[model samples]
Target: MDCCSPSRRQALLWAGVAAAPLAFAAAEPGAAAAAMPKDALLVTDAEVVTVTDSSVVITWFTGSATQTDRYGAPAPVPADTELLLGEPGNPGSTRTVYHDTAPTAFHHAEVHGLDPGRTYAFTARSAGQDAQQSTLQFPGTGGSSDAPGVFTTLQPPPGRYLFTLALSNDLHMGEQTAGIITGNWPPAFQQDPGLPPYPEVMLEALLDDLRKPDRGAEVLLVAGDLTSEAKPGDVARVRQLLDGWGTLGTDYFVARGNHDRPHVGADYAACTPIPYATDHHDCWGDVFPYPRQTLSVHQVGGLRIVGLDTTTLDAAGGTLDDGQLADLAAELRRDKDRPTLLFGHHPVTYESAVTTAAGPAFDLDQTKARQLEALYHRTPGVFLHHSGHTHRNKRTFMEESQSVEFLEVAATKEYPGGCSLVRVFTGGYQVNFYKTRADLARQWSQRTRGEYYGIWPHYTLGTIADRNHTVVRDLSGLTALRPR
Candidate 1:
């Protein structure tokens, strides 16, 4: 259970802090003095939320120069927003521009007619002012080359798109605050007084976006952490909201996370109790019970989707009991060639663990993690492992399971709030992260962007490639679950 030394985690955390603040003024000479003019509308946190072969959604925040929020950060201000895009390095190229004349603080623009597999240079402007000194440059580009911005469109998926699967996690329902990371110096973010809970706003936004025909997600996989603390009311409320979205067992599925594990308390006395911890009541279990067993498989057309419960009753780190591991191995052996997507709460790669301050607790225990990795190594059918605990967007590949991508997504209730759409095709598949675009969702996301010294984006907004990309595999085996 003691997977990694705390000394190593502390060392890595310090190293990350030292190297990550390069975006701050203290790390960059003249950055503080070169701050935007007080009167000029400031545009910052511009990022490509979702990128397909033909389109991409760009979102950013425009702050009011004359006003501030209760947190003492610049408040959102109305401004004209536009997207300037063209072929990378080709100023003379016929530029394509999309304008949202609505004059709002949280800007969301969708650009279409982009050529497949081509790289484009682009930037978002507000009131004709650019974020020239933005600490968080657009997702991909950085340094002097940020001008005109840069991102490569995903190459088309290998074949016809068979179905779309929405991937998201860490809703953290019932949590009253956001960005509560370590000490008091870095304050947490909270909803303004009297406002609906921020988590509710975000969850509704995510469901609305997924419901749109444009997104066309036939199934949804919420990796884990459905509740903030496994509170009974919160657990039931989460289920009620999700049931409004889709049927739990067929249309959508969820896994357990550390936060959703049962705790011993009087409030949960009426809830189901776990055998592993008999004194603890399982509120999460009572609301959304596992279908057949803790580890179960569902077939979508020809693709095999395995939902694994990785949370442990006793600790924050995750593990698979001997029985569950044996069940997974047997299921994989049932159809060795079937394309499989396994999702759980905790990440299963060593690299994902060290990157966060939580270290071992941020991931599955090394013993079970390696066990899962080795199982995937022998199972060519397993192509992806989706998880959400680190609350960041990171794509990792391990030598033992080179074919399976270990993906960690950011929380859906905070900055960069959104989900990824997995487009499964005959030849391969693509994963595109889409930040929720609803009005309140975008506004709340912008507010939370100020978390962690305004360097939050530096850590959470991963590279453009990490958010969107295509992979070629022999998925000819997968048939359409629903028509596109």
Candidate 2:
């Protein structure tokens, strides 16, 4: 692996970037301030979030050594931010594609006017200093050769455009802290003191982004983990936010995740009790009752969506239960040739790479997953399976179910804060991941990049191909839902 490869930098590193006031003023260009030592600039989490036929968005964080765990202590560094773009091995061809001299903790840049399906190398700079080195050591002056800063733009989806669906999950509304897996060995990340909770900020920003006309999202699907602990208030709040975007069950749909399972607590006393676990209250069920009942299907234009309630009464893993499993089998048998999209909270273990490290806790039970896979093999209409719980972006094709694409998306409440947009067409479809562009949303994402000892990006941000790609298949039968 190269020096700056994510694999080489898997070791823990204690660097954080959080919400802070920009206290430094921009110095005069090409003045004595230009001589600031390169070591003084602390930049981390430099990454490419969105890619298209002609543009890509890059984001990163700038922190100071004074203090980062709280607000007002380590002020935002004042420096010029620049994105250099060029073809690999062509130093003379490199040019500044984007630049901002503003003093800020969070940075976002968009480089436009690029050729489609072409590869390009990039380098992010703050205060005239290369930024990738702070997170991963760069060998010999930080050139982009064999570096993670390389990416190829995606070609547009084949055939005429049909409709678009916003794919997201793991909102974790009402959560107090993030990255608290297992013990304190990995360290947890919390929103800076006095700022609104990070989860709300991210979700609000997400809704706002979807409202933009260019996004062209006719429908939305959240696979699971919609709340922190299935609290009544959190569940209601999530529903309210989503309702503001579009009508529930029509414009958007949701699936139950492990975190949305029933809980035993006085706060949920007024909620409906889980039939299987009488002691626990189904707070999420009381609000989103449709998805909790059983496997359900919805038709949007020409696409068929099947939502599965993967959560068991109070378990961290998931199962479909006997009835839901039977219903699923019957449904697939009934419509074996209809183009279908299946979504749930837990990924099938056979297609999840995280299952190896996180075990069954991160995915559905192995037997249940195999059962679903066998059904998928028999159903030619099932083209995609969307899932959450692993909290990362991954693409896998199982041997038993070669016709379906198993896609796992990153959590919306943390680093790489965004969702995938699937564009359907007559020939096939394309999936592109996009980060929320709001200021607060971008800041929280940069702050949480330090979660898991600053290696969070390595796990959450999948390779460029995984985030953006096109798949060709005949789907001309489905009608396109034009934006109203």
lDDT of each: 0.77, 0.75
After superposition, which runs of candidate 1 have C-alpha atoms over 4 Å from their true positions?
A: 1-38, 94-96, 133-148, 182-185, 291-293
Q: Which residue pairs clash in candidate 2?
A: none
Runs in model 2 lying further than 4 Å from the true structure: 1-36, 65-75, 133-147, 182-185, 291-293, 351-356
Top lDDT: which candidate number? 1
lDDT value for model 2: 0.75
lDDT of 1 by residue, 77-183 (tens): 66767888876667787354888778777888898888997778887787777644354433331112223367667788777779999989999899887765434
Q: Estimate each model's TM-score.
A: 0.89, 0.86
lDDT of 2 by residue, 1-484 (tens): 0011122122222223222233433332222224445554567667777787777887776665433344222334556679999998787888898888766667888877889888898888877766663333222111222247677787876788888899999999999878765434356778877988888999898888888875778899999889998889999999999999999789999998888877787888899887766788888988997646388799998688999998876556777787899999999999899999999988884647343235545478778888888898899989999987778777776664458888888889987888999989998888888899888888788777766655666666776666677788889898888674
Q: Per-residue error at 477 for model 1, in Å?
A: 1.4
